[model samples]
Target: MSATPPPTSSPELKRVVTGALVGTALEWYDFFIYGTAAALVFNRLFFTDSDPAAGTIAAFATFGVGFVVRPFGGVLFGHLGDKIGRRSTLIITTLIMGVSTGLIGLLPTHPAIGVWAPILLTLLRVCQGLGAGAEFGGAATLLAEHAPPGRRGYYASFAQTGVQIGLVLGTSAFLLVQLLPEEDFLAWGWRLPFLVSFALIGVALYVRLRVAESPVFREMERTREIVRLPIKDALARHPRNFLVGVGAHINDTAIVYTLSTFSVAYATAELGMSNHGALFGVILFALTVIVLQPVYGNLSDRVGRRPLNLFSVVFVALFVYPYFLMVDTGVPWLVWLAMMIMGAFGFAPQVAVQPVFYAELFGARVRYTGFAASRELGAALAGFSPLIGAALAARLDGAPWLVAAFLIGTAVISFVAFYASRETKDIDIADIADIDIAGIDPVRKPVAEE
Candidate 1:
């Protein structure tokens, strides 16, 4: 029999992409706002009375708290996503993120609540982590499952674009608060951005509600083939793919967290840049990311995933040192240049194509579980890179090179991990699940119905 032709796009494709974008944007807005708060307000508001350095460390530790909870979120949500449907899982995650972030805006400070202030803050952060962990994997898998065969990378890249949109909005909000009087900004202005998330979340929920379920998922449901134990199946059948996905994702997460979140503190504390100056750098880089995501994603469609990902890893290794040097020079324009290059060109390739690449590592039955688990595992490592970098910087007496060395080591590990995996560019989506763990050809078998 002739092979089944790859599916073509319909009006449904547009709807799926729109849903992915809106939901992803809302989730990331929630995530990025916490990072902004950690940099500017959390140190003083939650960790008061500690030494300045200790306060900063404590605030960042809370930031990492969210990352710590992600893997459990991935497992919980991934199971539901694989068994129930992607559309429902995404909507649930969006609500969790939106509600948690809005409540953070309304929370009372340390003076009002004493030690309970940081405790409440950390608890909310864990909720944010739970939502964020599930959101990206579902969105990416939904988009990829709906996309036409040759354009999965291009379509799925919109999910990453949503992340850039969130960064733009979140960082821009923080920058706006900087314009207020210091007393006003510290007292009330910071709360404004968190409160505004309510409106954005409402809009995202409306848009997402209108989109239909993914066609591939629908077909699986029709065939009664949805795996009941997705995580177990993924672990048993695709261990190598899972490990490789973790490795490929680590460097991308590290670079982004370092540049956007950690850099704010690093620039101010070590490089002697003002808070406004560091925020401006973040804004510039966020804009660059917005512009570059689609370009690199489309490039992956043309050239391939392995080459582009490898190039990104190598570029980061080479660029981290120079990037820090430029930032340390305290030249505002040079800092802008450095951030733009790092965000737009250095990190774009892997970040843009990863949704499609990582999702494709497993078959449709376990795509959500495999992708979510591996991606969060990788991010777990990255989640700690900043803390490590901070400690290394302290030990080396504010030496940026030491941090650069650590980032380079992460890049090296990622490169080796990805190098060991099979390229999935031309593989048929339905056939991906049955592929061997050792990167060999699939042992062709009859397709099973749910």
Candidate 2:
């Protein structure tokens, strides 16, 4: 919002990137651990029912509960992030997420406390949701604002890289604990993963606290350009970008969960795959995503975000049927290959350009609120995907075609979104608020006196 923007230097970029990436990885570790637990252990451990099928559904319901409140969390924290500073807002969100996850470790189960166990479990999950709702939006905004324009996609993509790393760390934690005796695992091993959130909180706080606030937000503040209500403006002024942001998230959210969370369960329960084997596929998928995110991001920087966005969804759409078909084979190598392919072609490019794409979609004044609230609302909508996949499989006698069709539907939504959006790789992120949605009218003057 300042009349003149500040220059970004190479040194500052590295520091911001590290802080944002590391903090995001740690915070999302808390979130991913809960998802892995809901898939693997919570069904049996927390619920009162002995029916494995019912319990699994109940466990997944709790997982869905966390997503239910994410939009609220995004709006709340996004407002703070837009109103206050990105650095301080992110610190608070980190604390909220880490502390809630750690407490989940200490909660008693159904045998110990009956119905209270699940009720309390869902409560803690909501807290995690609130914290996570805006974590990536804030991190990406910070990194994007600090990055040089030509390489904005490359720099901001590290936040997504952190996301893959979190998934790996979370799955690795479960994989290690799975080696324990079954009795010990059900009794205590499951809690170990959640407990790690405590230590992660300390490390995350150190890094997040050191990170500087976004220069764009700081400039807005210095120029007295901060809006009284960011979320409202985001919706009222940039409705097209907001809707596109929501749709842009549908495919990745649904497909990633279908691949990572639901597939893990479906493989073990239906395909007769071992727990360890199915989880290994997840690790492979995450590693592939971790490697490809930056590659796609750097490529987006060169070729522009639109091309990658469009190509990524179409390729992923064509692969959905094969992804399920390969997983149904019951061969370890086949399953691993299947998951990796989904990660590379299905999930990577969309996520790679995602952060900077959202950053470019809205002006500085509403960036955090718009980017976070819109994306998380989409996530909340697709958050039930694993539950949907499981329910569909159960009804159709384990047939996966319905689920495949379901996934293709989400991909179509995201493809329309990507196609509808204008190119933003060349836009001035700091000055977008000055132009109206049609890009021809003056929305506001950058300087206060004007």
Candidate 3:
């Protein structure tokens, strides 16, 4: 009998990449706008009349709520992705995120409904969290499964590009709102950005709906090789890889959140910048990150994942303290430069390469579940780091060093965990399913009778 040939890459790969990038951009735009709102306006609107410090803390705590619920969304969506298909899961997540974001724009403020305002806002944020938890995993899997051999990193990095674009749009929109009169901005202008999400979500749905299912997933379905319980199988068969994947993502999550979301609160509350100035710095940083992610991703293709990822971590450890020192000087341009460099060059490489690295860690059978669970689990730690940093900032009298030290510690943990992982740069996607152990051993153990 003749052997069956491996699936070949076609124009479909381009379609999948385009769909993933556009859909993810819209989803993240919705998610990121919420973060920007929480950092700036949500507190005053929802927590009205509280102490400023206490309100900021409460606002960020609600931001962290989304991160807390994300893991559950990952599990739920991951199961659906592995069992049914990536296309449908992507469509569902985008709708959920869009609807929740639109609702937040129309929600009643504390003045109108008192305590129910924040409570309803928290409920909507949870819905956003659930949608986001699954969105990245599905997009990454869709791109990775369709990419040609030896170029998965290049193609998968496109999803990260969507993330950068989303951040850019989200922050830029908020900056635009900052230009409004103070009273108008607080009363109604802030809600305009959230309302804008509906138009972007429509674009995402159109793009995603046209893309076909991943070839690898279709093959698995045709062969009746889909795992009956993907999450359980992933846990049992790939515990070490899952742990490594989670650890590898720690720095990316922690540092990105710290530099972007937490920095807004830190600057306005602690460093005495106006809300507009703080958000403007974040907008500048987001633009740099958007430009640099694809470059770093292509660099990873040449240098391999471990070396580039390690380089990023080491740079983050060395630069975070100095960056904070510059920010503490209270010079607007210096703070902007520091944030731009930290986000663009210091943080981009790790974030750019991680989707490929994490996707490569699992086989086709459970790629969605493994990637979703591991990445979301790591992100949950990051979601809370801002709250932890806020608490520490209160005790330290807004000393930036404390937050820097905490970020560096997390980076070190990521570096060590990544160092211990097996390299998958040259492994074929089809063959990944067979790599059940970390290394080869010649000795075989006898099966014991149960």
Scored by TM-score, the top model is 2
Per-residue accuracy of model 1 over 201-245 as CA lDDT, tens digit each: 788888888887776777778777788799998888888888888
TM-score of each: 0.95, 0.97, 0.94
lDDT: worst 10-residue window of model 1: 441-450
Error of 1 at 319 (Å): 0.9
Which scores better on TM-score, 1 or 2? Answer: 2
lDDT of 3 at 226: 83
- Candidate lDDT scores, in order, read 0.82, 0.87, 0.83
**Model 2 superposed RMSD (Cα):** 1.8
> How far off is residue 267 in model 3, in Å?
1.8
Off by over 4 Å in 2: 434-450
- Give one digit per residue, the lDDT tens place, for model 3 in 1-450: 011225545777778888988988889989888888878888789988788777877888898999988888998999999999999999999999999998999999999999999999999999999999999999988888788877878889889889878887888888899899989999999999899888778899999988988778888787777888888888877778888877887888888778777888888877898877877788788778778767877777777888888888999999998899888877889889998889876788888888788888887788898899888988887787777778778888877678888898899989987897777777666556623454531012113300
Arranged by TM-score with the best first, the candidates are 2, 1, 3
> What are the RMSD figures for all models against the true structure?
2.2, 1.8, 3.4
